[model samples]
Target: MTEIIDYGRFADRLAAPRPRWDLLREFQDEWGYTVPAGVDPWPKWSESEHHAYVRALHEEWTGEEEDPFQGVDRTLPVPKALDEWWDLPFNSFTYSPRLYWTNPEYPLTLRPDPSGYGVSEGLPEPNPFVEPGGDLRLCCFMAEYEYCNEWAYLASEAGHDDPRVLASVGEDGWVLQARSISEFFVLLAAVRLPSHFGWSVQLGDDDFPDGPPVRERIEAAYRPMGFQNWRELGADTALFGGPDVIVRHDTGMADFAVEISGRSRDALAATARTLGWTWDEDLVEPPRKDEESQ
Candidate 1:
């Protein structure tokens, strides 16, 4: 039987060393950044409570279900250095599922066997000591990985194991994606924007010099809508905000193509007018007509 530990107290001690990651601000500054309306800040679950929840999960696995927790040498020990992680409120700018760890709607428990990354699902069988095999130590319930059990964000229990690594138990074998939690953040921040959003950039050229006129107009278009990708519109054309952005140079001001709906589009268009740029509402018309002919 695993003994319950004081997770909250441990988290307090660990908080001192954890990096002060302002993920929200970083996400907002990136181009094509968007978040849902009901965003709550971090520390969603208290450490003591969440650890109790995890222990309960272990009980469920070991009780009647077939002892999924059996024979794994690597136990999910509360690490002295990483107790702060359990207290973090998981929030991704675009994706909502990252926040589902404590969400009542999704449920907090993880099921093994076919539904999870288990031996039946291409993972290696369990061993006496926890080896990098079988299901990844479930960190949080990501909606993206709900269906697939191949890969997940894993926090190794043993101090000898990679402190924080993304482990994958695929058809090939167990592979680690990120070497450390710091490396994982870099990977998470670099995820591509979803296809639904349109991307384009405005630039000042001979026709529209990079001056107050251009800046003010861009502001009028972008600022009022609360679109916070201002760094992309900064003085330098060379710097790219992200993949979902358009970049323009010093010869002519190019029109922006936005995928937002209704009044937002109107506002952006109105702002473009300040720089003498026209919004071609009919640009998509020709393509639609062609598709209709087909």
Candidate 2:
């Protein structure tokens, strides 16, 4: 087992002097979780192969016999912090790698789109739908929660190292999600890291009516992961992490419940036994009685 490390509080972790990407890399390394290939575009294919694939895809769609990549640049045209985060394995869950670069390469992800640069973005610039009249124009990282009708992005001018993360809710206007985009990425890791494992169990009071106190039971067996209360998403989460398991207590925007995920079904059952939470194992994944009835 990975030796335990106290990450302090979630908000303070974001505020610490460490660079945002560095903080994220450090935490992920310590979390001891295997990162599945759900996010990120590299590693799944060789660099040369990936570029060739993109070139072929562009040609397939645009049908320009003349190489559109001729004298074209493919390095992602983004800021430094953004570039660093892009280099991290399975970065922010929502960060879809743009087919665009600055002189910045990994931490050299996607080598220079072969030296000879052009005066174009290589691809068409996406129309920014945010801050219509202000300086907060959209750039590379635009986070839209399609299900909730809300979205956020790094709201800043071009070439900014890092910018504020702002999100919109039902026309109520943008709310401050984080002081900097990097912190926002950390917040994403808190949830996405566990979710990447592909199992989540939401438990309400009814699921464990006669069990010990919820927080007390959780604190005794697992390390409280101190995830930020995502008010913009209309939810606050109390997260706990332990050997091969992650449990989250969510309140607001819906019901007060806990979400649990484990590396395997056995791990889930073990966590359940420790916390006094139960579920119908015969069901597909482990569902609460409330959900089974629904």
Q: Give per-model CA RMSD.
A: 16.4, 10.6
Q: Against the true structure, whose TM-score is highest?
A: 2
Cα RMSD, model 1: 16.4
TM-score of each: 0.35, 0.52
Return the TM-score for candidate 2, rounded to 2 decimals: 0.52
Give per-residue CA lDDT, model 2, range 1-294, as digits (tens). Answer: 334343324445656687677777665555444344444444311233334565577768978753434432234245565656655664533233221111111212211123222111111133343344444333323322222323234323334676655544443444555566677667666665544433456677567778576777887877665444544356656667776677777665635567777655666777788888765655225322221111
- Give the alpha carbon lDDT tens digit for every residue of 1-294 in model 1: 022222113223223453534532333233234445455443433222333465478668878443333323334443332343333353342234342222210112232332333321222456322475544444432212232222233334334323443333334343444444433333333332211222222332333554555544433333221111211111111111211222222221213323221112333343345456545554321111111111
| lDDT measured at residue 185 in model 2 versus the true structure, 0 to 100 | 69
- The residue pairs found clashing in candidate 2 are 75-100, 75-101, 76-100, 76-101, 77-101, 106-109
